[model samples]
Target: MTTPLLMLLILTLPLLANRLVGRTAAPAATEAAAAWGLGLVFLFTASGHFVQAEAMTQMLPPWVPLRLALVHATGVLEIAIALGLFTRRWRTAAAFAAATVLIAFFPANVYAALQHAPMGGHAWGPVYLLVRAPLQLILLGWTWGFLLRGRTPKRMPSRA
Candidate 1:
C-alpha cells in the first residue's frame, strides 16, 4: 500500500477503535487514544525500516555512517518505544526518548526532501517536507503531554 494511506491508517485506527468502544471526545481521552495510535505508527514505521530498507536508506544524508545498520537499529528502538507506550510504563523516560528520536530524525526528512527521494515510486518535494515537519513537532508534543501528565512526587510513608 502507499505510504500516505498507510500513515492515515496507522494514525486513525486506534482513535477510531477508542471512540467505537464508547470513549468520550474529550481532550484527555483523545490524548490517551493518541498514545496508542502513535505507538502503532512507530511500529509500522519501524517495520518499514527493515522491510523497505533500500527506500529508508535513500532518505538518509550521505554523512550518516552505516546507513543500513542505523536503519535497523532505529527500527529496534522504535519497537521498544512503541511497546512502552502501549504498556503505559516508563512514562517520563520513554516520552523524552521518543521525542528526542523524532527531533534527531528531522534531518533525514530534510535531506530526503532536498534530494528528491522517491518512496513507493514518487519523488518527495519541499512541499511534502513542509507538511511533514509540523507533524514531527506535533508528535513530540503528544509524547510529552500524553505520557508526562500529572507528575506524582515521591514522598516518605507516614508512621503507623
Candidate 2:
C-alpha cells in the first residue's frame, strides 16, 4: 500500500531529478536514486517503531522479552543503516545490513498477521501474507539489484 508507493516514488524521483539537471551520468544517478530511495524507506519504517510502539510490540509473541526495547533498538538500527547508505564507503555494508534486518524482522510480520495484531492491514488475516511476502521479496531484490550488484571487482595484474 503506502509502503510500496513510497518506495516507488522515492526510487524514481532521484532519477527524474537527475534527468532534469542533466549533470550526473545515468548509471551513477540510478545508483544514487536506489540508495537514497531504499534508505528513505528504512527511515519511514523506523518511524513506525515509535509512532506505533504498542502495536509493534504486539507483533511479537508474548514469550519474547523486552519487546518495546527491541522495537526501539531496531528503529535505531534502521536509522543508522539508512544514513550509512548515503556514503559510498558504507553503501554495500548498509545494503547487506538492511537485507539482513528485513529477513530477521519478517517472522514478526508473520506472527502479527497470524495473530491479527490490530495494526495496519494485518486484520486481513492470513490472506495478508499474499501481499506481505511479495513485498518482502521485492525489498530484498531491490537491495541486491541496486546496492550489491554491478560492483566492480579488482583486476589482477597483467604480466608483460
Candidate 3:
C-alpha cells in the first residue's frame, strides 16, 4: 500500500524467485516474481513522474510532451519487460532489456535530483531520485548477473 512497502516487494521478489527456482523444476515462481516486481516498479515510477510532472517540465530543457511521453512509455516498457522475463523463452532477453531500460532512465533521474524536483512539495525530493537511480542500476546489474552466472563458462587466464 505504502511506497516503501511496495519498494520492498519490488526489491525482494527476485530473491524469492531464486529460492522458488531451486524448489521447482519449471522456475514458474521466479518468472512470476520478476513479473510482479517489474510491474510494481513500473507503476511506482509512472506515478512518481506524474507527482513531479510540474517540476519536471520546468527543470528539463527538453520539450514537455517529449519528456512526459518518454516517461510514460518507459512505464509501459517496464511492464512488458516484466512479462517477458516471466516467460520461459524470453527470460534472458528480458533481463538484458530491463538493464537497458534502467540505464536509459538514469538521465531523467539525475536531472530530477539535480533540480530538486518538487514531489508536490515533498521534502525528500532529491533523496528519492538520488537513491532510486543508483539502486536501479545496481539492481539491473544484479539481475544480469543472476541471469548469466552458471549458465555460461567463465574463462580463466593461464598461469605461465
Candidate 4:
C-alpha cells in the first residue's frame, strides 16, 4: 500500500513540478522522473533486507539455500539497480535488470503469502496475493512503459 503510493508520488511529483516551471515539452524529464521514482522504490524495498533481516529470511522457502545471504545479495542488487537507473548509459539495462529481479522474487512472495509468513503484509495470509500479484504486474508494466519499450539505439554517423 505505502510502497505503491510512494512510487506514484515520486513518479508524478516531478512531472507536476516540471509543468509548474513550464518545461512541458521535455519527454526526457518524464523519463528521468520515472527512473528516479522506480529507483527509490527499489531502495525502499532493499532497506527491508537489512532492517528486517529475520523477517525477510522467512519470506523464502526452507528449501532455498543460504536464505539470509541470498536476501542480502538481492538487497545489494536492488541498490545497484537503483543507482544504475539514475544514469542514461545504464537506465535501460537497469530497467531490464529490475524487471528480472521482480520476476525472480515473485515466487518467494507467493510462498510467503501462502505460508502466512509473519512479515509485514505477508501476515495477511493468502489473500495478500490479491494485492501483491497486481502490484507486481504494475511494477513490470512501469519498467516496460517508462524505461524499456520504444527506446531505439542511437545510430552512428556514416563514414561517407
In the order shown, the candidates' Cα RMSDs to the true structure are 4.9, 5.0, 7.4, 4.1
Off by over 4 Å in 2: 20-25, 150-160
Superposed Cα deviation of residue 86, candidate 4 (Å): 0.8
Total backbone collisions for each predicted model: 0, 0, 0, 0
RMSD of 3: 7.4
* C-alpha lDDT of residue 147 in model 1: 65
Q: Enumerate residue pairs that collide in model 2.
A: none
Worst lDDT window (10 residues) for model 3?
Answer: 146-155
Per the 3 Å backbone cut-off, how many clashing residue pairs does candidate 3 have? 0
Clashing pairs in 4: none
- lDDT to native, each model: 0.75, 0.82, 0.60, 0.84
**TM-score of decoy 3:** 0.63
Q: C-alpha displacement of 112 in model 4, angstroms? A: 0.4
| Model 3 bad stretches (over 4 Å) | 1-5, 17-40, 43-59, 63-65, 120-130, 150-160
Cα-based lDDT at residue 53, candidate 2? 83
Judged by whole-model lDDT over C-alpha atoms, candidate 3 comes out at 0.60
lDDT of 4 at 121: 80
By TM-score, the best candidate is 4
Which digits, one per residue and each the tens of the lDDT, describe model 1 over residues 14-127? Answer: 779988999888876776677787788888888888898888888887788999998899999999888877764554455666787999888888878777787542265677
A best-first ranking of the candidates according to their TM-score comes to: 4, 2, 1, 3
